[model samples]
Target: MGRRILVVDDEPDILELTRLSLVREGYEVETAATGEEALACLRRSRPDLVVLDLMLPDRPGTDVCRVIRTTPELSDVAVIMLTARGDEVDRIVGFELGADDYVTKPFSPRELGLRVKAILRRGVEEKTESEHLKQHGLELDLSRHRCLHRDEEIALTAKEFLLLAALMRRPGRVLTRERLLEEVWGEGIAVTLRTVDTHMKRLREKLGPAGDLIDTVRGVGYRFRE
Candidate 1:
């Protein structure tokens, strides 16, 4: 079967529209109209990606996003926030909460579809690269999407793994924020430079002592230590 997607939105029109658009893209689409229902659906059937609306009837989308991130079973699920709010703070909050992407309310279904495609495509690309990379006692099994710090497994979100992979693939080369954005998040997505900073911080923390491998280049960007 095609990749599955769960679209959560209180508006019936949006739920139907998003389902239709995604279905046309060959995705298996399911939807929920409330946060409670969405969580229930998630427990029953895990989707590859969730197109979540920020404003919901029963709960704020941020809460739901947080739940997904904190739930071990749901940590790998990609989320794209759909909201009418376009404020920078809202965007920052969404990203900080582990949203994979954010789309403003007045959005084109085609564009949203493309964004979903990009996110999913990136996930696939990550798995097909070089099988293994080792540096300073950190081991990354790119094909298996596993990371090890001195033989102890380190759990990483999809974004965190990808960001680390991008840096390691070009060790010693300073990757500007814009370059990392394109390499890790893909092109044409609505994400800010600070988003890179947020993921990098989390990535570093997860890497533990190996965190120092990723060096900050002051105002320019980050580079994996040579």
Candidate 2:
């Protein structure tokens, strides 16, 4: 009765290990050994969460994630990408491709479970907030965690919203990248400051004409227009 999870990895041992760990915690675990297989499984089994490996025998994991995102049928599924190392570029790219979270290899099973649980919880909260944010015009509803700009609903990822809230809280005041991450992502995770930059760019583009709302501070970081 727990959330259904699809874990995509080529290594049999890794797949079994993940399956056992999640199964023990009562998750309905399904797995795929290749990118192609994962897509097929997705059609048959709708998983609440997908744990994907960046390396796949067929298409790369990033491509798989992108495909899932482009396919309207599968866009809503939450994804956690498994990386090979502290490859920062892949991490950012995965996020851009719509992976909700990421974990490095040799990762702790407990940590992955916690990440999965947190993502699922966030998804539910975001859905509720999105529904409530329809009233605000071109402004973010922080209480409900949603954004509406010029009466048009804006789809923001978790990190994007966090970044926007940080910039908006100090409208017209320039914020350094370090400070933005410190405020938005918190001082935790050791994430690169560039993560803020990446999210900001995406957020701006999504905001359209309101995109100008996020102003780069040239030598410093950025600021939200007042």
Q: For candidate 1, which ten residues in a row score worst on lDDT?
A: 87-96
Residue 58 of model 1, lDDT score: 93
- For each candidate in turn, the TM-score is 0.57, 0.56
Q: What is the lDDT of candidate 1?
A: 0.88
The local distance difference test score of each candidate is 0.88, 0.84
What does the lDDT read for residue 102 in candidate 1? 85
Residues 136-184, candidate 2: write the lDDT tens digits: 1467787767788876678898888888877777777999998887887
Query: What is the TM-score (0 to 1) of candidate 2?
Result: 0.56
Clashes of each: 0, 2
Residue 222 of model 2, lDDT score: 97
For 1-226, candidate 1 gives per-residue lDDT tens digits of 2299999999899889989999998999999999999999988899888999988999999889999999999987888888786785455445578888888888889999999999888876765566688888888898788999989999999999999988888889899989988988899878998999999999989888899999999988999988
| Model 1 regions more than 4 Å off | 89-95, 128-130, 133-226
- Compute the lDDT of residue 73 as modeled in candidate 2: 88
